[model samples]
Target: MIMTKPRIAIAGASGFIGIYAIEELSKNFRIRALCRNLPTTNSLNSDVQWFSCDLFNLKEAEIAFQDCDYILYLIHSMTKGSRLTQSTFDDLDLIIADNVRRSALKNNIKHIIYLGGIIPEINYGISRHLKSRNEVEIVLTCSGIPLTCIRAGIIIGSGGSSFQIVYRLVKTLKIMTTPKWTKSLSQPVDVNDVIQFIKLCVGNKEVYNKVIDIHGTELISYNELIIKIATLMKLKRTLITLPFFNLGLSKLWLYIITGIDYYTISPLIDSLKYDLKANHSLYFNNYIPNPISLNDSLQRAIENEEKNEIKPRRKTFEENKVRTVQRLNLPMGWDSIRLGKEYINWLPKVFFTIIRSKVNNNIVRFTFLKINLLTFEFSDDRSSTDRQLFYIKGGLLVIKKDYPPARFEFRISPHEQSAIAAIHDYYPSLPWPIYRIFQASFHKMVMYLFNKHLIKIQNKKV
Candidate 1:
């Protein structure tokens, strides 16, 4: 009998850990990347396939993970912008995880491997963050698939959230006043070791339905880890711990100094109230024998960051709202044709729209040929661009790239004689749950059309 490499679907392939997981796992498994957006072809393995998907939607998830036997569950909303509060994030994580569970079962997926937090042994000191992580595990296993949970503490590696937090704190501070929580014990694991352990679990019956503990070579407090990292970087740093600095103060310090979002870091700080040393973890030695040491992992983490090997794991809400403005000058003004009346009229004659219908308004609309009508509404934005209006999209902060052109009716001197054209984009901010996966080339197409229109107006050759 010819044996086939089990097809594995990665639900969050665009994330930092997810991308690295794909790169390492591709050699052994047939890879399928399911993400909110399509990645560039060159970034994927030749045999790898991509499915644009939104996990919150079960229909999309079913299609994305179809025909795959195993799932590498790397989705987490701790840093996701849509997750406003820790409570909100916990609810959202449960919803998304449950959706994945249902979809995985629908697709007949057999096993799921999850990377989650290591909970504190004491039930009384359990945090909302830890509870959320536990809930995800519960939801994943409720679907009846064997869920392999790899509980990790602070992960020390380049591009990792936990590592980045420590790096920023150490790199930015010379003399620091840290909070009381810094003294808590933490066992951090290397990114490479984490990846290797995940690789070892594939097709392993021993790891099924198991909760494994994976950490660094030794346990240390955050204070010691900071000092070690500082020594490695050859920096002189002084640390004074104060119990009075509460979570609010710590959150503010991280926000103001490190420039990381305080909302995301706040809950994590809350969870750090207790020690995060792993206990009773099913020994990973069942598969892989060697684990990377903290010194080597810390050194490699810095080297990777310095070498620019780190890529962004997740996007803040602001990244989704891409805005672009292109300006054009009509050296010779329109004589007979006023504004784009002629151009607008000319579009229907040549432009290929999927539908032959449109709504009549102040803003002219051109719909693209797609499953959904991608309509570009061109209206005047009250500027030298022969436009006088900009409408705000649903809760999106509309940014006009250039300040509404500084116009002075009271002439200090003769203004330059030219018709200025400007473009504006208001991308609506949709909640992550219902977001539909679509091609990203729409932005580039807008620019291409804008430049082409300028050339045409200049009476230049094609």
Candidate 2:
């Protein structure tokens, strides 16, 4: 008799850790990699199954998790997912986590293993990035499934954004201007060790429904880390500590030297103000007795880069695409479906009656002076109490051929007190400058007014 391995689905399988994970975990289980785009080559692992899915859509997430026994959720949206994103990373992370939670419950998965950040021992304040990670943890836990969340700090690996910032800073600057946040302590774990920790947690009954922390053997300050890296590279670097260097100046200095985007660097800098170390000491120590050292991990990262181990990332979005997400207060008696209907009904009262809206059967149209400006067809099959989706069917404001029509959606948040009105993959028919100047501004103004309307309703109920 032959034995079959348990099937596991990996979200964010195209990322730095995800790519390595697919190679290592495929030897033990049947791997199904969920990504936004399929890999051009099957060289990573031919046996690994790849499913292209946009996790924002619940139906897509459900289909991606089909027939999977365990889930490895490694998704993060530090970089914008669309060409134009009007939402914060925190909200973006929350929505994606909710989708993952819903999909996991629908599929009846056995376990979910999530990779998150090591929150500071002092839980009073944290960076938005870390807060977002914590929010994702909550959403996944609320699914009533067994979850093992592994928290780590400053992953040292090839192609990792955090490590690359450190590496670039040391290489580029001969004299570094240090801020007070550099004095904060951190335990930088190696990516290989993270992968090993994940491997041990899968199907492990003892670690189920627990939060575990993993870190490198050495605990060093960020200043010490910089000096150590300089020694390793055989470079003589002078560091000048500036007591009064504010967050703004620090961000600018790092951005200028490391060339990392503000979106990726901002929250990371915010996190450096707090000491980040592993609290659980012996939980998984038996499995990984000598979790890799800082010196050796740095050496490995350098070697991997020298050998060109990093692969090129495939482009995920087309040019001229736009995504706008607006969060509004949900009335006490309102669900997402109700909020969506109210929006359509309120359109006629907008812009001093210049805009008109009409709904016929499943189709909806918005017009100016009886000339159609936009059209949407309600998706009956996709509508639910928590979410309502409308397909951008046609109108003067849309292109003639949209392969899969762009979507306009209203979705309730995890806590149910708020809702989001979002437009995804929308490409305007107007010219870029014209759309940016007039159409975009008009859309935002309309949403702002709608938010005000909701607030008034809530006040009345009070």
Q: For residues 331-378, what per-residue lDDT tens digits would candidate 1 score against the true structure?
A: 355421244454445445545543333436643344545222323333
lDDT of each: 0.66, 0.86
Worst 10 residues of 1 by lDDT: 405-414
Write the residue-wise lDDT of candidate 2 on 119-232 in tens digits.
Answer: 998888778889989888988998999999999889999888778778788887999889998888999988988898898889899898999888898889989999988888
Candidate 1 ranges beyond 4 A from true positions: 1-3, 80-87, 309-462
TM-score of each: 0.67, 0.94
Highest-lDDT candidate: 2
Q: Lowest-lDDT window of 10 residues in candidate 2?
A: 309-318
Clashes of 1: 9
